[model samples]
Target: MQTYPVDIDPEQLIRWLEAKHAASPSVFRITAVRATDERMVPPRGTHLDDLDREDLREIATIATLEIAPAHASEGWLLTVVVEDEVGPRLPDKGALIEDEQTIDLVTFDQEFIRTGRGNASVVAAVEGPEAEKRMARLLHSIEADRHNSGPAKSTD
Candidate 1:
């Protein structure tokens, strides 16, 4: 139940996630790719590496978490797209794509207000051992990144 501040480094977040899949033979069961700010605009094919930290901080973000289970050689490829938005809404989850094979979808909007002095809320639908391990790694990476980035500056 650790808490992550609302103002996280978007670029670092994406890099950490990408690193999970870049390991030898890829240790991650799920791979997450993120596009923040104006980089999410246009044809939507902008490379994550092409965007800098400042650009990431100034625009909206869309992160796609792609999962691959460990059983079948080609397991179902489910994609979870997380989009940033403003305003009010209770956190929840719903099906974006459901079928016999793939179950691609988006979770409820995990809001992070700039003025709010609190942690961002996340809702994960996936479960089981692999999923748990993946989540733990992601969380650990985030915490480490935050700490290494130094203290948070006053946005007021």
Candidate 2:
């Protein structure tokens, strides 16, 4: 696996994933951004852009990890939410991330500033096919809006 700088720009991260998709046809991207509402109340779908400002803030702190397995059946994307909430059912039903994993968060909290690798890893993880599709869809929507806008005319 190739290694990249940890402190990566979000846009750069997306481009990297796009490259990965081009190279590997089977690999899929899974994005795990932070959750804004402790309640986990998102619009209820795969649309990452639907994530609100609060959700983005929460995602900024935690690394959004994505993994794509070689086998299609085995491939599944998830958003890992790092917090104190641990139990059978999460604290809030609205929170979509219903699972948790034990990771050395020292890197996410204390060491990212010094090493910069923690956040970069998070961005790297999301570079997969699924992620590319979602990103493309969102971009298409934005482009459609711009195209639909009427041409500008002189005020004079």
Candidate 3:
């Protein structure tokens, strides 16, 4: 997704995930993620001199996880099944995201809320192959844009 969803609710995410899991054994896969910052989409006409500490400030994860899935509660963190090959987590978190994982909705939702507009844009594929294909198409389109070379978010 692009800009952080300010009204994200962990409980709502859990409900959706519970419903999704109930309907089918679908996993919440995050295929591609690019670590970025608010500066990535700075206000038009702005230059580096216009930036501030917060503008340049970026948040890498402070924790890999809070609690195990089996022990997860609204008061605690949930499980995220991260796969191998991405290497260590970077401040951008691009490496972490690219490694791929099936994340807990509660954890993922809470993160977007807590981070606000700090974390860079990430590519999450929640609906499996269709989502993946859509992301590929979208990124492909982004790659075609002559004015841009970094990640972008589309609100529509």
Candidate 4:
């Protein structure tokens, strides 16, 4: 499997994840902050300009995917920390936050690349008989999305 670099778009990743796993009761949270902002800076010798644009942007993103299986006592959590340059463009004090019930379908083609075991481990982490079905569906959806020409359709 290909390993996607940390520069992948957080929104796109979130969308792909949502597209494949929407049936399950899952929540995806994506937060982006400026790396050089006063709140994010350290008091040490490091200067904000010291870091390259890519690094600076990448250091700004915080993302988490949580899955709760139906009738299950416990759920699974998958978190990814990466960088992106898109945050600076967002309004609302250089931070963009998204919390929604359904995944917003926007074009995410080329935003993420297939990598690792995919999110199978995350699905497996859910404890219930439905885990296997969910896992299979997620895997298949991911594969289909990977080869598709455009972004996954938005359910909006």
Order the numbered candidates by TM-score, best leading: 1, 4, 2, 3
List, residue by residue over 1-156, the lDDT tens digit for candidate 2: 222233434333444444444555344534343432334444445355643523442222344445444443432332222333221222443545434433332333333333443334322223456644543443343334332233211121
Candidate 3 regions off by >4 Å?
1-14, 27-34, 38-102, 113-156
- Number of backbone collisions per candidate, in order? 1, 7, 0, 1
- What's the TM-score of every candidate structure? 0.29, 0.25, 0.24, 0.28
At residue 114, what lDDT does model 1 achieve?
28
Q: Which ten residues in a row have the lowest lDDT in candidate 1?
A: 103-112
lDDT winner: 1
Candidate 1's TM-score reads 0.29
List the candidate numbers ranked by lDDT, top first. Answer: 1, 2, 4, 3
Q: Locate the minimum summed-lDDT window of 10 residues in model 2.
A: 147-156
How do the residues 1-156 of candidate 3 rate in per-residue lDDT, one tens digit apiece? 121122223333334444544444322222222232221333445454544423443323322222212211211122222212222222353433233234444455455434442322222222344434444444344344322323222222
- Give candidate 1 misplaced runs (Cα > 4 Å): 1-10, 29-63, 67-123, 128-134, 145-156
Evaluate all candidate structures by whole-model CA lDDT and list the values in order.
0.39, 0.37, 0.32, 0.35
Q: In TM-score terms, which candidate is top? A: 1
Local accuracy of candidate 4 as per-residue lDDT tens digits, 2-107: 1222333444545566554454323333222222221233325544464433243322322224333332432322334323323332234556444322222221
Is candidate 1 or 3 superior in lDDT?
A: 1
For TM-score, candidate 1 versus 2, the one ahead is 1
